[model samples]
Target: MVSHERENHFVISTRSYQADVCGKHLITHKPAIHECYGKGCDRMFPTISGMFIHLESGTCPSKITLKDVNAVVAMYTHHNSIIHSDYNKSLAAMLNREDPPDGFPFHCPGFTPGSLCGKRFELFSGLLQHCESRACNHTFGQDDGGLLSFLHKVLYSESALFKLGRLKANVYSRIELVFPEVLRDGEQEHLEALLILLQMLFRKLLDIIENVQSRLKAAISKHINYQILGLSLGHPSNLDAITGRRGDLSALAGEYASITGNEGRIAGPERMNTSEVFVWNIDTGECQLLHLFLEETTAVFEILSLETQPQ
Candidate 1:
């Protein structure tokens, strides 16, 4: 078999076989081996990228969403060059935005009903079908600069900030695992002040929260007419027990509500995940829990600096 084989021939092994005719081969590799810990998928990979790519491709039984992949990629501080930095911000915006519009709003450019490839279509899909028909030598697939490729580019650039604008962002890491560094008792003295600072910050935040909570509690008790005061599962994601409906805060919107013609860009409670805790604002009386954690600050204008922008 070796004697009859092509010079660079190498057999790629997996649970399923790939024909040499198509490019299913894993190109990036390393000397170290790693295993896919996904359920029933113990397939070994030559590099971490290979494992993530396999899982993200939906080939593994344990399916990982592309968004989850992007989230992890954004975590690596060194990967600011290739990957999207504001992944969270963009996703929050997209999720808040209405789903993609349906049907063609405008006519197909550079084509008409009288041309050799002239079948006018009002329905958006009818035009896609025409493109895929290849009568006009335009295809929806991997054809050079076609509809699919162009949309992929748009999603790449707009939806996320991949500098190259290529889809399927994977993270390459130098360290396999992290363990805390050990320090002797004498050496730990230098870190005591930092630990004390964290404790002070937590205590300060607690005091502010308690004061605000007391005010809100008193108001809720005084205003018995408004129903959302003590609703369980008040979050928009889960159904409320008494109401048997997703708790929509927007129900409170009234004639005084500020109208901005631009919609979908404004974040809502619906964007909050099950794992996050929402913080209320005492001044605005509105919940803007868009960030993972609430940051309450008392910085004066005189103290303003680049580092104090979060305030």
Candidate 2:
């Protein structure tokens, strides 16, 4: 069960034994010393408030800024909503249609009740050509709908320092399973530290997604002509009905095919099976392991720098 406390801005999930604060989760039952749920900074705090303050202070080696945490919280709030889930399901259903049109299915906010420019297509490639030839300003926006919208907002917003943090989190989460094991005691400690950092960043990204959703919902309710509202309101097929534009997934599939020279196969957003994608690629796995080691080293340097600084 989920219990929300508006006064303290907390959400408690009994099944998960987790308490959500500002979009991030903390394991409860021990108030005096709180351990950060962030991947790398599992450090204990004297109090719950102290842990929150530490996260906000950006003192953690992961370099997770206050803005980063806030963005994550916003993202988490919207993504967990029932509306977003329903929208995704509807879009997926449309894509699975047996007899799709000739040009790509596109959603055009510019198309109101009567507009000649709002035309549908079956193939996304055709839609792209048409948009370019006609100088139309249409863009793709429905890979993960709400999540993508949140990312766009974060990208264009003023808080630019942690712009790549979310992307990094995505990459790490996907590639983490293939991480190499270490035999030496020193190497094992380093590996553990690196994994923790990755986890911390991943959690922060989730929170940001939630926070963005909440903001988007509020904005949609208040403003009639918000650009995001158009994107948010229209289902995937709505664009196809008005304008022949392809969703982000189809476009990505096409791009992947072109790059990989794979015929008739498209890459979906689903997580790749580790055995199929990485187990045989020893070199690639090693590279990821090395990358994590480098990150750990950088974090150590930052911590040392902070320690030696004159107060």
Candidate 3:
């Protein structure tokens, strides 16, 4: 005896069912019946009496109520706040201490296992000073070790999230191929929401890649500029000695040129080939022929020291 409005809320309504009231419309000689109103409970029966019997039997699936969703969100929010606050307090306490004594090596707080450069500082102040460099754009407590640990605990370690990450690439590809077929007869609103979510995920991934690429490009450019500047100031007398070792230098320079698409050549006093090398002595304000062989892939520099020990 339920009205059409009540029936609409309890069961999925269609255009054919609009003309009929009490949700007892006949479909192919069998009476079309209402489904259970509970979330995820889709059992149907030809008669209201039969539907009621099933509800009373307590075999229906457990409904996910709004209260349950709210409780989980609140619990996670509170936990995140507590952990973030404690980490911030500890960082502030560590930064307040006086600098370590001279000659004592102090490990830089920003240097984590994941950092590209594993550089240490001679003093606490030096470590703090190194943090100012853009190349080492890392924070002490917030980013050094805390962010990854927190993400591992909350996301990576979670079974569902880990599986989602692993399968996301394949899922996206499959969805691209099958989405139109699967959603052809589906609700327009649901399809639109799914599309929007997919677009957002793709855009976020693109943004992360773009950011990393830009930082890498800048670092490479800076390193090359420094190398070129050092070569420009080398003594002319050492040019012959450097030219003799051109094969080693050319190999290193060719690799750099290939990666950056920039000509790696010396343009000082006279243009030198890739095989020529240059060395600058900071202490004596002089440039000598070191004939250094640089391995581009590993970035290891082999220097042939020309200093003669007092006999």
Candidate 4:
């Protein structure tokens, strides 16, 4: 799945159609063209247009020094892989919470014998026995063990492959390890460009998370109202884990409780019927709509900024 190509310094991954250039798979987010070409181009070009044409056409300005395209390819591929691992981990976390597994294996076959071996074996045998007794129904459950196994593999497999030394050396070797010589030629600018891009990416991620949190909060509020029969029943609670850690929603919830008092309670709990279920469904739909909107927006911004370094 992971391969090195002589034509391009990048370690190509042909594992799947969905396999990402670095680690990310979204077709809309191919590696930034500028970042890719700039890697081997001169530091100073009067205009981006000049830079673009020179790189696109494989032409070089007489005054500007250019490294081999192999170096550029290496940097692009290496950085992409690092970013992919990070974003993929985050995505996995979100998906796992929304769709938890139905069952888990007691013993992890992938775990090697070592300090945790005894514990692992016990746990493993327990799950296996449990599975056999249940006719392997656990395997078919939503919480199947396969997901856990895969997670383990991705998190630990090939620990040496992604190391800084390996990635950096491989990337540098694209031009016969000329990165050091480039450094002597003023690598500071290149380093700065990389930092700017990474900073921009970090900020964008924060925006995405904040947007999701805000929408999630609203959804929670609506759910509470539908379940309790009215938002008038209680002040908004900062039930959000992020808000709670900062003491943000707690005081507000208290204030709301005081204002609403007993008036917020549904007049008849026993009288509530299946008709209210329809209302809950509607609220759920609205909540999901908000989340979807935020997600799309985040993806769009990320894609747009792919090639632009932070200003």
Best of the candidates, lDDT: 2
lDDT of 2 by residue, 28-86 (tens): 33355546533346688644335545655667554544444433333334432212232
- Cα RMSD for predicted model 4: 27.4
Clashes of each: 0, 39, 1, 9
TM-score, cand. 1 vs. native: 0.22
Tell me the tens digit of each residue's lDDT in model 4 across 1-311: 24334234565645544222432222223333322122223345432223433533434321111222212211221223212232333333322223211232123222222332211222222433333232222331223233323222221111111121121221112111112232323334433343333223333233333343343335333212212111112212422322222222234333323432333221222332212111111212222232232222233333223212243
**Residue 187 shift from truth in candidate 1, angstroms:** 72
Candidate 2: RMSD over Cα atoms? Answer: 25.3
> Model 3 scores what on Cα lDDT?
0.30
Q: Once superposed on the true structure, which residue ranges of model 3 sit more than 4 Å away at CA? A: 1-219, 222-243, 248-311
- Model 2 residue 2 CA deviation (Å) reads 68
How far off is residue 173 in model 2, in Å?
Answer: 12
Q: Give the runs in model 4 whose Cα sits over 4 Å from its true position.
A: 1-182, 204-206, 216-311
Instruction: Please list the residue runs of candidate 2 whose C-alpha ends up more than 4 Å from where it truly belongs after superposition.
Output: 1-90, 93-176, 180-189, 201-213, 221-311
lDDT of 3 by residue, 148-226 (tens): 2332222211212111222222212322211222222333344334434433333333323234334334543422221
